[model samples]
Target: MATTLAQARSVLADAGAFGFPVDVSRRSDPVVGTRDSSRPEPFATLPRESAAIAGEVLAGELRSSTKSDGSGEYEAMQLLRRPVARATAAATLGAIDDDARNEVADAALDWVDALGPVIAAPAPPYRWSRARRQEDAARKSLEGRIEALGDPTPARTATMLAAGTQVPIAAGAWLLVALAERPELQERLAAGEVEPIWVVWEVLRLTPPTWATARVARRSLDLAGVRIPEGGVVVVSPLLLGRLPNLVPGGDGNPHQQLARLEVERWRDPHVRPGAWLPFGLGASACPGRSVGLAQLVALTKWATSASLHLAATPSTDQTRGIFPRPARIAVVRVEGGNT
Candidate 1:
């Protein structure tokens, strides 16, 4: 694995020399050909209008379900799922009618769900296995929906929607969990004493959804002084690189005292770059939805600051599909104007 930030960047930056571990030539999916050519990346800058719409959707959903059980508690994953899906879909399928956008969103979510088991399995299941068959059905359903929306690249669109939807859902949940555990930090955020973006950055650094990524060497090369033969695999871990002292401020001590600790102010230093750890990967293949995803998390943090939320139960890390907070239950104890 590339342990240092410099080494990680070196590997990721050499996109021509390194390629994804998967052998796409053997894949049956024709859409893979268009992935690199997909146009108008979803919410590349997350315009204000789209951001406002997403914020409204999130706020409306959370408000309606805030105290449904009189205990003010709700499952984080379930609570944010549809809203994230819809918001991402709207941003992805720009100018599309609401009905069509919603349909695509739901289909993308179904594809993501069906994809989870297949990804989490210990080994690739047989092509004719139930898991494979179900995943294939989900993919076709999503692709069909995207195609119906009139996207020139339906397969690429389907892939983008599914990828964008799932990661933000997990990232947003983690942001809320972090805020809930730190009332003082929330208060700081509420008072505008802290940057919401900083909080989001810290959470991403600590628990990035795509913690590690692999690259296969296209030819023999020297990486950070280590010789790697052609076809050799190298892993770059953002989670580990985020711990390096040079990359993150206040990470000069022990692991727990460093990036492991959620100190948002550590980013206050002007010279230290926020994303040097490359939480979203690097180079041409870096996450295309980063801006939209970051906007979603920042908006969530802003909303969270206006309300007091507490954890109803201890959430655990789920490694099934990237890292996520499983059973992330939180109680909406109070809103800005009144108790929930």
Candidate 2:
């Protein structure tokens, strides 16, 4: 009566080839958990298993290099790539079988190793709180000098970008959409009427801007006249689906309004159903590190917004992947009047 997990994956892959969007509607299939389902509950699980493997590779390589003191050319590259590698590893681990997980991990490590140095590191060394505070403080001081000079500084830009600040920019955009309908929420935030921490948690619980994701069918799947065959990956972009007109009550055409309605339906009250508004994903192949990712995003957003940091405007689009859709060039400016 239902399509097998393997069948669905095959369908997704095939559909991807033909440029068809995979339909991720609940009517089509159930979201399955990871292969190692016995480990723990989704939210409580530590990404340690995945993180350790990645860290080993990353740390090992850095240790072996002549610049192992954390100041060599490799340092900047590691700073930029490590998070991406960790996120990718976590996502891959969540999506694959146990056997494939190790392989993917190894492949990712090798890929990172091969990438050499980061031409443009994403964020500054100081932005990563994990780095020594002195380093961050010194970098912050230097940044002030560079800003005063009014000259473009690649290193500073790279460091800021790499420091995880960009995540909040994306989060803020999403929050703006959420606040559009509930102006009161925005007012409360501005007036300090609501606890900032609570707001962060609420935003985390809210589904991402995009909802469903699709992959192509590699082969024909013959169900009771459903017939989703090979080479037909019809993915539902959650952004579009979450805002789909029919899903909204009273038929408002605005995507933001639909998003607000969905949020209310899913999060505003208790006793909500489990599978509505799957922004991260649903089924066995959902993004595993979603909790950590959301945590990082919320933390980043709270810090940026509270400090009155303004981000440079940039274009962001979903390239059909359902996991992360963020803006490309999000520049930051401190309203407090210092280069951070």
RMSD of each: 4.0, 16.4
State the C-alpha lDDT per candidate: 0.78, 0.37
lDDT of 1: 0.78
TM value for model 2: 0.40
lDDT of 1 by residue, 1-340 (tens): 9988778888877666776765111133212122343222332444566666665555565555556432467788887888788888877778888788878888888889988878777766667888888888988998888887677788777777888889989988898899889989988988889999999999999989888888877778898889988778899998888888878888564855766788999987777789888988887778777777887787778767767889999999999888999889988766546322
TM-scores vs. true structure, each candidate: 0.88, 0.40
Q: List the residue pairs that clash in candidate 1.
A: none
lDDT digits (tens) for residues 163-237 of candidate 2: 222233244344433443354654455456554444443443344533334454434555335776554444544
For model 1, where is the 10-residue window of minimal lDDT?
23-32
CA lDDT, candidate 2, residue 324: 28
What ranges in model 2 sit over 4 Å off? Answer: 1-212, 216-219, 222-225, 245-275, 314-340
